[model samples]
Target chain A: MAAAARVFSEKGFGGASLEDVANEVGMLKGSLYNYIKSKEDLLFAVVRPDADELLMKARRLSGTDLPASEKLRQIARVHVEIIDRKLPYVSVYVQEIAGRGISQEWTDMDREYMSLIEKAFMEGVEAGIFADDLDVRVATRCFIGSLNWMTRWYEPGDPVRARAVADQLADVFLAGALARSRN
Target chain B: MAAAARVFSEKGFGGASLEDVANEVGMLKGSLYNYIKSKEDLLFAVVRPDADELLMKARRLSGTDLPASEKLRQIARVHVEIIDRKLPYVSVYVQEIAGRGISQEWTDMDREYMSLIEKAFMEGVEAGIFADDLDVRVATRCFIGSLNWMTRWYEPGDPVRARAVADQLADVFLAGALARSRN
Candidate 1:
């Protein structure tokens, strides 16, 4: 699956073939078919687990007893860590090639993930933690956009640097870059 | 050029043919070459002006005497406004298609625009307005990433809703969604 994920990220889901995945893993094509039924199945194998894990983690966080701000911080940290850990899968997931309709699973996962974040913001607004005037939907988009884009630029292997980025992102999302009470 | 921009955004630069662009404008392929030397030139024509304009406007804002926050606000407004006004153009410019073997013009424009924003954030940090701990480059990337992804989701028309989105994005970028203080 990891090999397939890298192939899909590089060649795109539609462009990647069963042979490509097999070659990636140094296996014969027939041998690969024993493990996966088809190319579409390979895509699902590579992408679904990542999405499921993200959705599960996000649900757990949103369902937590912690404050909204704290939840959001944890959510941001987890999001950054996930992207760092699964850059290949996440990159392929975000690309338009994945939207070509081999499976409805990706779309379903995306919509649910978005709604979960939206619900988090709505709860923040309700609890009077986030500003009342905050556009929860748009703010959710901003948050997701900022986090999702990490795959485009972030490189793994630097855990310290990656953690710093995640911390700063959570900080910016919570308190922003402007100093509190400007002089 | 507008037709070409739309075609490029939809089909991608490499995937799009001169014939497709020509057909988009309802022009004969032979006549299209009179205006453009090749497909790459068509891409440059469609994307370059928008990048140039953004850099020009951002440079103008950065050079102003306005505070960094105010400048950022205006820049954000203008950035969103530009994306709103030229969705098709902006969409194509940001796509990987534009990253293909185009002229150096697009590359230079992008760098200048990023440097301008980075400089603005650096100024804010220096003036003790933005947080001293801020990583200016990553922060600038965050800002650009937030603003750039708007092209993926923004719908044309409805100026009021679009303006609201722009304002909220700038607000979030500066102050975030959390209430004034930690409770």
Candidate 2:
């Protein structure tokens, strides 16, 4: 699957072929069929587990006992870490190539992930950590935008560098979302 | 050029042809040849002036006498309005299609724009309006990322809504960048 993911990432979903995946795996095309039915299935294989893991980790972050600011910081850190750890796979997932039509799963996962971030903002609001009238939806959207846009520019992934970026993002976003009195 | 921009936006630069541009203008391809030698020329025509105008406006904003927060607010407002006003043209410029290979102009324009935003951050730092030790480059990149990411989700352009979004973004971003004492 890592082989397939790399192939898809390097060649793009539309441009990648079953042979390319097989080549990456050092296996012949005919033998590779035993593991996957088709390229769409390969794409599903590539993206689904990662999304599931990301969603799971987010749930854990939301349910943690930490303060809202700390949680947001950790969330940003983990988010960037995973993005770097998974590297090009996240790149392909965000791109959502023509085969994005193959299923609605990606769209559903995206919405769920977004709402989880909103949940963090809401919790902060309830705790008096963020502004009472904070536009949680807009704030979360912009927050996510700032992080996700990194995918466009952050090629040649380095886990340490990504961690630093994560810290910087969290610091700024927390400032942006803080209760007026807290600042 | 409006017709050509629309055609390029709709068909995509690589997928689009001279015939498509000519047809978009309701003319024969042969007649279109009198104006543009090639598709690359048309792309240059469409993008250069919009970019030049955007840069000119950014320069004016950098020279403003407004406080940092208000300046940032108006910058965000004007940024969103232009993206909305220009709609798919900004979209195309960001995408940097195959024809993007034709020149380094887009890359340079993008760098210049980024630096302009950084200048805004520096001015705030110098005014002691933002944290003296703030990571200006990171802050500016994140700020621009927040706005540019809007283009991905903000498909239906409405000036009023774009303005509202601008205000929200600016408000939050200023909150993020404000000095500790100010808060």
Candidate 3:
């Protein structure tokens, strides 16, 4: 799975071959087939687990009794933690899932993942925790966009710095930079 | 140039061959040599011009006596407009410019382009036009990430929608979700 994630993240979906994954694992291509069904299966194996894990965490956090602002903060923290923990898999998810119609099941799973985030934002807006005029759709995209790009540059060993960055992002999103006292 | 952009964007720089570009142009691979010196030359020709044009626009906009906020808005608008206008080339730029040691010139050009946006953000903060706590580095990445991802989803014929979306993104970045009155 690690080999598959690394190769897929590096070469993209259409560009990577099963043999490349096999070579990385020091296994014969035929031996790889004994364990994984196909290239698509390998791609699914690499990304789907992380997606499911994220959805689970998101669901657990959503069910919390926290206010919307804290919920949003928790959501951001969970997302950053997941990316930091599973950097290569998340990298594969970001790079491959967009264009390649690997499977309808994966696509639906990916949408459900996004819907989870969107729901959190919507909940915040409805509860008057977020600004009234906030466009949920655009804000959701921006949140996802910022999180998605982290895999490209985030270094895994620097969890403290990563967490700090994530907090800053949540801060920027939840509260505008204007001096509230002045207003 | 358009052919080269399409081929390179679709196949990536390492994955694409000169023959692919030649085939896209409905010409023999050998005949392509009449127009360009090499594959690297073709890539530079397609991408550098777009970078040059963007910098030229930035230079012209910088000369204007606009306030920092308006200047930043204009910079964002220029980014979206350029991506909308020259999508294939921009797509190529997004996909291929990273991880290429031989393309140091293109990499330098990209850094220069990104620095332009970063400078605008920093200037806004300095002028007290933007929020004081803005982490200029992260904010700049968020801006570029949002703009660059547009190539993955943007439909060129829908200029009205594209511009509207760009405006929404600028609003989200500059003012954030929190209302101005609250700020």
Candidate 4:
């Protein structure tokens, strides 16, 4: 999967072939077909673990007894950590997920990920832990957007920046753009 | 340009050739080369206008005497309005900008757009208008990402929703996720 991810990231999904993944992994092209039927399958397999990891961790966090705010803070950190660690896989995932040949599971997993955050926002608002006027869907997206945007600028091997982003973004999301006290 | 943008957006910069753009704009493929040298040029031409519009508007806003926070409030609105209005061109820009054949100006304009926001964030902090401890780059990117992320889900012809996003996001950026009063 790591080999396939590097191939796809370097060549793009459309440009990559089964042979490239085979070359990357030192397998015969025919042998590659035994495990993956097509390049899209290879692409899917490469991207799925990262996506699944995010969803799985999000589910575990949601299942916790922690408050919505704390859940989101941890969610933000986990999200940054995974993306920081899996830049190549996540890059291909972000670029190719919108194309048609990708599985419906991609869309489902993405929606569920956002839905988890949306639920947290609703819970926060309901518990008077967040602003009552907050549009849960909008807030959820904006928060996710802030974290996911890191993919554009974040470099791998820079755990410190990623950690700062997680903590700072969590702070920004929690405290918002609003100043703590007016000067 | 509209025709070119539609062709590029539909067929993609790589998939679409000079002939497709020429046909969309009702020109001879040979003649089209007289006006536009390559498919990449056509893309740069189409995407450039929207990019220019955003930069132009941001430059205009920055010249105003408004406080940095107020300037950002308007910047948020303008960014949303432009993206909502020019979804197709913007979509193509976001998707294709990183590919090799695209122009350098694409990256430059994008950086300038963000630099404007970064400057505002810096001014806000330096002038005691924003939190002193704010990570300007992170905050600026987070704010811009919240706006840019709208591209993934924002459907065209939804002015009401666009306005709501602009206002809500601006508020969120300014007010932040912090509660005004903790329970």
For all candidates, the clash counts are 0, 0, 0, 13
lDDT of every model, 2 decimals: 0.78, 0.73, 0.75, 0.79
Residue B64 Cα positional deviation in candidate 4, in Å, after optimal superposition: 1.7
Which rank order by lDDT, best down to worst? 4, 1, 3, 2
Per residue, candidate 1 scores C-alpha lDDT tens digits across B41-112 of 777778777777877899999999898888888888888888888988988777653322235766666677
Better of 1 and 4 by lDDT: 4
Tell me the lDDT of model 3 at A123.
Answer: 82
TM-score of every model versus the real structure:
0.85, 0.80, 0.87, 0.89
Cα lDDT of model 3 by residue, A1-183, tens digit: 999988987776667888999899999999997898888788878887778888788788877877766776777787888888889898778776753345787667766666777787788778776677777776777777777777766677567877877887777667643334464
- Per-residue lDDT of model 4, residues A1-183, tens digit only: 999888877766755778988998899999988898887677778888888999999999988889989999899989999888998888788767732234677778888888899888888888888888877777888888787767777777677877878988877777765457543
How would you encode candidate 2's per-residue C-alpha lDDT over A10-101 as one tens digit per residue?
65565578998888889999998998898878887787776788788888988888877777788788778878888677766765431123
TM-score of model 4 vs. true structure:
0.89
Model 2 CAPRI rating: acceptable
lDDT of 1 by residue, A3-92 (tens): 988897776565577898889899999999788888767777777777788889999998888888888877777777778888898887
Interface RMSD over true interface Cα atoms for each candidate: 2.8, 5.1, 2.9, 2.8
Which whole-number lDDT from 0 to 100 does residue B86 have in model 2? 87
lDDT of 3 by residue, B19-71 (tens): 99988989999999999898878888898877788777877777677875566
- By summed lDDT, the worst window of 10 consecutive residues in model 1 chain B runs over B94-103
Model 3 collision count:
0
What is the Cα-based TM-score of model 2?
0.80
Instruction: Write out the backbone clash pairs for model 3.
Output: none
